[model samples]
Target: MRVRRCRESDVTTQIDAHQHYWDPARDDYGWLTPDLAALYRRFGPADLAPLRERAGVSRTVVVQAAATVDETRYLLALARDEASIAGVVGWVPMLLPDTPALIGELAAQPKFKGVRPMLQDLPDDNWIANPELAPAVDALIAHDLTFDALIFARHVAPLEIFATRFPKLRIVVDHGAKPSVRDGAAGWQPWADGIERLARLPNVHCKVSGLATEASHDWTEATLQPYVAHLLASFGAGRLMWGSDWPVLNLNGDYLQWHAVASELLGALPDAQRDAIFGANAAAFYRL
Candidate 1:
């Protein structure tokens, strides 16, 4: 892991709400192709510990990168040994009949806090909004587990429908629905509008992560400022959370760079609000 000295902040309990730990040699990560050379190898807690420690991040919510229950179990096993993992947002076959029982078993694990369906990779933008998946979604609510919506801008509307349909399900929009940062200011319309609409739903939340990858190769903090500002305006500090999106983040930048950029972008906020975005909100949202 690469380390950079970052200026300390007032955040006492920093939690990276969206990150991953995977070993392609052991698991089937369909997306882990050789083309993504920078991320084709193993990435585990040992590699992340020093980076997070250097950035003053004490805990993390390790989310699912593969669309398999085995991958979820792999993360759960990792969390068992890695104390810094506050929770594991594992995967469940939501469209299958046995989802409820499977969820019951996973939720019994103390660190299993939620589920993510890899929505962005699916062919149907409205896949998550399917009424047939209600049983699985209900099971999440029954177990007090969160639902991490891994989506893109195109899926925002369907996500709104899903959120409204399951008002009690605590849903956090990973990567602010992945706005079109590469399009620059011109790409703000539908994405911004969609995010604002999702914010109106009390149960919906967003993450201040992954924007660096969404922007151009030479992206700077100024390139991300407007999007961050829009997120703050839409969700406020209470509903937003900070994350590293590490390993994948390595494609664009390192953990320290993202953390520093986030701190700089949010520097103007009062310490209390900044604290919430950095840690408290994730603690509350994931019940960590």
Candidate 2:
């Protein structure tokens, strides 16, 4: 990746806050079905190297796309080997009795920064807030591991409850809380409201990622600006961070295309503030 030093004091380095790598042949990602043929094949560090370079991303946090602990282990191994991957957001069996042990084992590894439950796939929207999972959540807090909320807007209310229940636990809402951006203004309010409520918690952060894929086949900077603006207003640059959402982003837009769009959306902000959104906030949040 091309390195450009920013002169502004608050402006520092650029990091891709969120991205993923998957080996379908090695791991069973049920979501990686043939219907999504474009992403069905292997996506490793080499596959993402060019995209990161094209987008000028200096480092990245590789997140889990599968629910298995084995997948998390795979990512952790990659983080150890790949220079560009600064952190790994691995998965945990949230409902299992032995979750704390799983977290402890993974947390022993240097680059295992956080854990994410596939909340959107679970039938119960209230799962995160369930008291039965308190030990697991507490284990994450104890280990200083972040909780990556891989959820849809419907899961946001429960997420707020979870955040409130554990105030000091670091939480980041992945993919702008993944609103249905194709809905335009009429369908945007629920996600906007949820994000606003979640941001009220000092400990919660939001990712300005994955918007392009939520829209229909034809999405543009204009189509995504309103949602981006809402996140800026809700989270502020200090609490917000940028992510390519990469291979998934390929579903709607290329890596550089999304990067350019994100830059355009934040054009009004001062360079320092934009730097926080693009890089600093994530570095601080994930301890990269």
Candidate 3:
């Protein structure tokens, strides 16, 4: 696949909705156990700055990856200091009793635009089913906060229940529901089954990021076809958005490669649709 070369001036704006930030020294990332030590490198706004500029993405929403409440507080504080960071999606231990009240306190911060539970890290399939987490999930809805899901495809059943249970919450699925492209479309059936179910929820949206990493380390656009095509077909341009997943995506592809590959996929679509995939959908979805 080839992307038509265009002058940077001809390209319009875009946003990296699924990007993340962390200052290991200034903050805690003990979550990066030695098992995932390679990911322990420093990554913050400085690392993303060039990727954002290169891809013509003026604004970005930095979400939490750390498993701590202080991580949320840290990003909210960072958002206040950075203009390029238009929004922040931090974590809150929603299963706890005071979740609703605590979220009420966090929402007053202008940049605290959304919340994400560490769904991928859960050991139980019914974690979202917990009665305690229900109101906590609802707390985000009550405060008009966006909910960004970090679940893998295998956990789709529970994800479906959560989305259905809280129809009022504006949910965005990250990483194309995390297709196992590395497995050479190894997990397509299950991921697709879950994605289709998740798509049925009109309130839920999806962001196209982290695809390169999911595929084989040496993946091409063709390697990512099954998942990418399904996303476009499932969510269409209106419900889909784009993100670089940056420094992390560096493990798979650089910003320019991601830019080229993503543009190749979208350029094949109608101009209006490409606009929506690139930025319009995210701007509207996150109210950025």
Candidate with the greatest TM-score versus the true structure: 1
- Ranked candidates, highest lDDT first: 1, 2, 3
Global lDDT of model 2: 0.86
- Encode model 3's per-residue lDDT on 179-216: one tens digit a residue: 88777645777888888888988998998998888777
Clashes of each: 0, 0, 3
| Model 2 TM-score on a 0 to 1 scale | 0.94
- Per-residue lDDT of candidate 2, residues 1-288 (tens digit): 122323335346789999999988975698888799788888999998886776667799998999888898889888888999999998888768888988898889989999888788889898888978888888999998898898887887888889999998999999998998888777787787888889899999999999998998788888999899999999898999999898998888888888878877787798878899989899899988
> Can you list the residue pairs that collide in candidate 2?
none
Q: In candidate 2, which residue ranges exceed 4 Å CA deviation?
A: 1-11
| Ranking of predictions according to TM-score | 1, 2, 3
Error of 1 at 235 (Å): 0.3
Q: Output the lDDT of residue 189, model 2.
A: 72
Instruction: Please report, in order, the local distance difference test score of every candidate based on alpha carbons.
Output: 0.91, 0.86, 0.79
